[model samples]
Target: MKVFADLEEFTQAAGTELGPTEWLEIDQQRVNQFADATDDHQWIHVDPQRAADGPFGGAIAHGLLTLSLLPRFMHDLYRVDNVAMAINYGFDKVRFITPVPVGAKLRARSVISKVSALDNAAQATLVTTIEVDGAQKPAAVIESIVRYAS
Candidate 1:
């Protein structure tokens, strides 16, 4: 993880790709829990038996379920020092390019696109690319923005 004691330390290091987070497995139990919470109990996401005859030949996780893992992904990615708190501003862009199959392992690669001042706080945007292990393409790409206060 890259530790920045101040905003200046972070802004000076733009475009650098931080190391990836630890691999997180997408299991059926977790997917089902997400489905239960969101009322998105779609067959492709929760019905393993029926999904076995579906497009992926097995159940797959919902895109939002994978997207919701951003916090865990970022926690394992990087951190800043001397910041009182950081709030999620929002995502500028997001795309689920590939389906995350059950039991797949995934991680995120982040590039600090820009960091700018916002009154008494600072806003940082990161182009976070999430990829699945052994997969030829990325699973998702998101422009995540956050506001940090000292």
Candidate 2:
């Protein structure tokens, strides 16, 4: 993980690549829990037996489930010390590029794409990409925004 002394230190490092975070498995249980929580009970994501013959050849995780991992991945990527608060301002862009089949392992790498000043804070946009282990394509790409305050 990369540690910045403060938000100002973080702003000066634009285009820096933060990490390919520790691998995380996408299991059926996690997928099911996400489905139950979000009320997205699609057969392709919840019904393993039915999904085996579906387009992806097996159950796959929801795109939103993958998107939700942004925070988890970012925690493993970088940290800014001496900040009183940090907030997930929002995402500027997001795209699900690949189907994340059940039992797949995923990891993320992020680039500090842009940064802008804020009152007692800084807003940064990280272009984060999540890739399925051994896959040719990334599972998702997102421009995640965060606000760090002193």
Candidate 3:
């Protein structure tokens, strides 16, 4: 993991490449739970037996479920010290390029694309590319922003 001395150090790292962190499997249990939480009980995501003959050949995770792993992915990448708060400002653009099937291992690589000053904070834009093990295309690409207040 890369550790920055402070906000200035972090903001100066505009072209920094953070990680292709350890992979985490998208298990059926996790997918089912996400489906339950989101009330998206789609057969392709929840019903493993029925999904066996479906398009993906088995149950798959919801796109949002894969997207939601951003926090987990970033936690393994880098950190900045002495920040009082780091708030998720939301995404600028998001694309679900590949379906995440159950039992597939997923990991992410991040780039610190830009950092701009706010009145009481520093806003950073990270380009997070999530990849599925052995897949040609990324599972998702997200441009996420965060505001760091010290």
Residue 10, model 3: lDDT of 80
The Cα error of candidate 2 at residue 16, in Å, is 1.0
TM-score versus the correct structure, for each prediction: 0.95, 0.97, 0.97
Estimate the TM-score for candidate 3.
0.97
Pick the lDDT winner.
Answer: 2
Model 3 regions lying over 4 Å from their true place: none
Better of 1 and 2 by TM-score: 2
Candidate 1 has its poorest 10 consecutive residues by lDDT at 7-16
lDDT of each: 0.88, 0.94, 0.93
Candidate 2, 4-119: lDDT as tens digits: 99978987878899888999999999999999999999999999999999999999999999999999999999999999989999988999999999999999999999888878
lDDT score of residue 14 within candidate 2 = 84
For residues 1-150, write the lDDT of model 1, one tens digit per residue. 767878657656668788688888999999999999999999999999999999998999999987898888888878877778989999999999999999999999899888887676788889998999999988999999988887
Q: What does candidate 3's lDDT look like per residue over 1-150, in tens digits?
A: 889888888879899999889999999999989988999999999999999999999999999999999998888998878888899999999999999989999999999999987776789999999999999999999999988998
